[model samples]
Target: KIFEGNGAIAVKLFPSNVNVTTTLALASGKIPWVEIYADPLLNRNVHEIEVESEASKICIKVENLPHPDNPKTSYLAGLSVIQLLKQLSGGTNIVVGT
Candidate 1:
């Protein structure tokens, strides 16, 4: 079954980074309505997700910190890219996680 209605949510965050929305799109397999905010008082990036489906209603919140070595990127995002590259290079016999 798939969600079959128009849904809306407001995504607010610092304009400097919006990768979380991209990540969420990938996870949910759909592009979501997004709104960005540049908050000077925030020391960390924040994301909130809300989903309403026939079977369930789900909400998620995440706070992210910049990579220690690279301030422009999230540490986990960088690692995920590297992990994908490793998988594509066929260096390992076992692949883990979706």
Candidate 2:
């Protein structure tokens, strides 16, 4: 059951070193979930994700990589600025997912 199940996932978790909390939260990764923290060498540009469904909760982390086009910024940097401006300008939320 460990190697084969109806549900399977592959995640590359870095050196949060590890976590006891997620072990309990996702127990056996059965309900479909995992957690991780970034350990990208000495990088500090942190990124986080939180996912939850009726069955389980998962959290992930990564040290954000800077956009090659802009070392001081991540790709989302442009999108974020646009989003904020949209918000301030009263733009609407375009529905993305169901």
Best by TM-score: 1
* Candidate 1 segments whose C-alpha is farther than 4 A from its true place: 1-16, 23-31, 92-98
**Each candidate's lDDT (Cα)?**
0.65, 0.50
Model 2: CA > 4 A from native: 1-58, 92-98
Most lDDT-accurate candidate: 1
The number of clashing residue pairs in each candidate reads 0, 0
Q: Could you give me the TM-score of model 1 versus the true structure? A: 0.61
Q: Model 1, 1-98: lDDT tens per residue?
A: 11222223332333345556666677898877664555778766676778889999999987778789986677777788888888888886554697
Q: Candidate 2, clashing residue pairs?
A: none
> Candidate 2: RMSD over Cα atoms?
13.0
